[model samples]
Target: MDPIAPESADEVFLTAEEYEAVHAAVRTVAGSRGAGQPQTLNSLFEQWDELVHEVEEGYGWSAPELSNDLGCRTALAHVWRLLPPRVRAIRQPELDEIDRRFHATTVGWPGRDDQEGQWWLRRVPRHLEAETSQRSTHGWPMGWDVMAFPKPEAVEIAD
Candidate 1:
């Protein structure tokens, strides 16, 4: 890999369609997951490297290859930045409900109150027993908590 050449005023770049094909190829390889082969974001970049080589060999005359590894990495980083949220939209109300439920049994009073303290302690055993019994029968995810939820991208507001 060579250092990135500084863009000259007269240099022409490849068409958008050519680069987009490379990006699409990366997505195609990433999505074709196989048994015992869990893919991560790094795997996408690795696939992109291979695609870049193929593209360079196949279409070098018309579509100039990206300069180097840095170019390939930067191109994919740009693609990722432009991507919309990949996770499902999480509602504000649902997040609020999770927050409420998480804190519901806590004794907020500054001073110790026997009844306030005891109420939560009493609920713990019942909640645990129910969670244990329901887990296997209903296939409820064990230790399902707000922290376990995948964070979704926030809506971008235009000023």
Candidate 2:
């Protein structure tokens, strides 16, 4: 099978070194919840917080955007997708509670827009849903498996 080439120069493929670096950064940011321990909502929320902080840093900088970089985005998406079904199930209520608390305290604060207040709370869930939908529709994003060489489709020439 011939390897699949990037259709354009704009597409980013991680080299072996870059893949390892990104993988390590992701793991460092998305810390583990003890090997055998059951994941609680708090633990999951903590993980979400850490992941968001890492991805959303340098928000106004002119430097390369971490949120849009293929390797960083894919690595973060991979971590988000790894959350177990039970943890995913609890996400909405947790998010709702966060929104509730934010609004509860911020009520009557000057110029506080609901959308602005809720943006952080909603970001991860929105990203996860988009990634899940894309995966279902288009299969995994290209460069998802950075370590593996692309495989070409089999062809049969008709005589």
Q: What tens digits encode model 1's per-residue C-alpha lDDT throughout 1-159?
A: 111112357443434553444345445444434585534334544554454344333312111122232233344444454333321111223323422442342222223343542222211110121223323222322332212222112211111
Q: Per-residue lDDT for 32 in model 1?
A: 38
- Which candidate comes out best when scored by lDDT? 2
Candidate 1, residue 116: Cα displacement in angstroms equals: 59
- The weakest ten consecutive residues by lDDT in model 2 span 150-159
Residue 26 lDDT, candidate 1, scale 0-100: 40
Q: State TM-scores per candidate.
A: 0.20, 0.24
| Candidate 2 runs further than 4 Å off | 1-41, 44-86, 108-112, 116-159
Candidate 2 lDDT over residue span 9-97, tens digit each: 54534456544443444355544446854333244445444444433331221112222422322333444455443333434455455
RMSD of each: 22.0, 21.8
- Minimal lDDT window, size 10, model 1: 121-130
By TM-score, the best candidate is: 2
Provide the global lDDT of candidate 1 against the true structure: 0.31
